[model samples]
Target: MTMEKLIRFAALAFFSIAPMAVATAQDSADYHVTVTLNWTEAAFPVGFPEDPHFSRFIGMTHNERFTLFADGQTASTGLGLVATNGRVSILKAELGEMTRRKRIGSVVEADALKAGAGVVQMTATLTSAHNRFSFATMVAPSPDWITGASGIVLNPDGPWLESLTLPLWVWDAGVDGGQTFTSPDDPLPVKESVRLAATPYFLHPAGLLPIGTVVFVRVR
Candidate 1:
């Protein structure tokens, strides 16, 4: 081949391969998440239970197409299990399906907070394609109350936030009719949309107080 022709072919090959490389390259960031539960009787004196505690926490790093839980939406069977029974096996299976479908990047789980006031930490990896996070945990001994945050964007624009804190509010799974912490299992005849807990249990004299907080800090 002629020198000019060889040079032209080489340039075309490099440009084509460069575009493919750029398309396949994905930027990822690591974060350390700290979940602190403040559901002490001191902070929430109303209707304090005997053993105030939080259930096992489950979270996901996902893209815009996925949601762990959302307000005004019906709870999935797996989420219902968490809220009603503080179980994670079914939810983990659901997350596995989501992973197979490429809807989520990672599933993060943590040990339960045995006391009302404690902290649980976990690490997560977020890619540019999946920069949002969602998490949830049940209010132990409750009928169907849960606490969590959903649709949180770790990287809104191009840069990841150094640190972000989100207040955790109690939500009703709408799967049970029992209102108290130790109420017996009473499944609702029809499912209701998930929403913030409005029962007197969570209501304070001042207003609704958050039960916990989740803090995300970029580690790398």
Candidate 2:
């Protein structure tokens, strides 16, 4: 099989063979998630384009046994695809397999968003076991810049009573060395993914900063 096919097959096989976790009993609940991409001159360099835009938003509501990406852990090949190429098919397929296995409750993907202002909203199901949400989106033109939250617990101690909004920070997939928005290069796999250093690593002369916000609301 070709490398791409191999990747897809591997992803499918992974979730297929993985054991399902024992779910904890809890009252079922639904959540409305609103993810907004808000970028201003303060967030990115002046040279950032309005066209190419950020890649689609990809995420999953899953149990603690599953996570998409971690701060100091190695990034999966599906994550590498989203972070570097703005592609979602591979990851989506993988998540689909996970959903079938009951490892993930649901998967989410939004269209490519423009530079300044864009919003995508979706609803997700949550149980006591599958109470965490994780997501990611690629920063265009760069080698492997991405942004999203990992392991956001819906209701840690009690039920969510109010809507919550949090600032989203930029991350380096640690898989590429390019520094610019449009870094002309191929994916460079790293030993592992780490939190992007605090130093300015983007087009902004001053360095990197929070580029957006994510809002989660309890609808029922």
Candidate 3:
């Protein structure tokens, strides 16, 4: 099926069966998570000549020690790959190390998406030590731009009983020169750590355009 159609179908199916899919995962698997990244027409950034785009999603469920990125932290070699080139190989391999060490629970990846919306789902094994989740994707044709979630908690005080949704925003990978798209000198490292973009685009404030939505559902 076409990507747009598939996204719509996935959303529909989720909402349609969600009421019946809330069984406790302790009975079988650990956790069943369905994460959807969406960009509605109304939420699309304005005053841009072209539509924004996104790289494939790369997500992980890990322990407290496994950090993806923080506002003031250094961007890892893996994060640099996605933020600069829309690539996931390096990040996946890096995360694989944590998997072997049992520092992380699971890692998930999905295909690149166009200017609109897309959905990617992952299943996570439950553990008190590894209860945080993080996911990210690159915004293309810009200098080290990205959007994702970090340190999302599951079953904080009790069993996870409700679905959660969070608004996505753009982030600067801090390795860029903050120049125009495809600029040769762009993304020149400033020796600075990762942080939010100072300006996401010309018309919108930092990290505000093409405002994406991320939905997390517990389906086990």
In terms of lDDT, the best-performing candidate is 1
- Model 2 RMSD in Å is 14.8
Q: State model 1's lDDT.
A: 0.89
Q: Using TM-score, give the best candidate's number.
A: 1
lDDT of 1 by residue, 138-171 (tens): 9988999999889899888778888999889999
Candidate 3 lDDT tens digits, 11-76: 999988876665533322344555455554455444332555778888888888888988889888
What is the Cα-based TM-score of model 3?
Answer: 0.74
Q: How well does candidate 1 score on lDDT at residue 14?
A: 100
lDDT-better candidate, 2 vs 3 = 2
lDDT of each: 0.89, 0.74, 0.71
* Pairs in clash, predicted candidate 3: 176-187, 177-187
Model 1, stretches more than 4 Å misplaced?
1-26
Q: Name the better of 1 and 2 by lDDT.
A: 1
List clash counts for every candidate, in order: 0, 4, 2
Off by over 4 Å in 2: 1-26, 46-52, 197-208
TM-score winner, 1 or 3: 1
On a 0 to 100 scale, what is the lDDT of residue 107 in model 1? 92
Measured against the true structure, the TM-scores of the candidates, in listed sequence, are: 0.88, 0.77, 0.74
Per-residue lDDT of candidate 2, residues 164-189 (tens digit): 78878878787777766666875564
Give the CA lDDT, 0 to 100, for residue 64 in model 3: 84
Per-candidate Cα RMSD to the true structure, in Å, reads 3.2, 14.8, 13.7
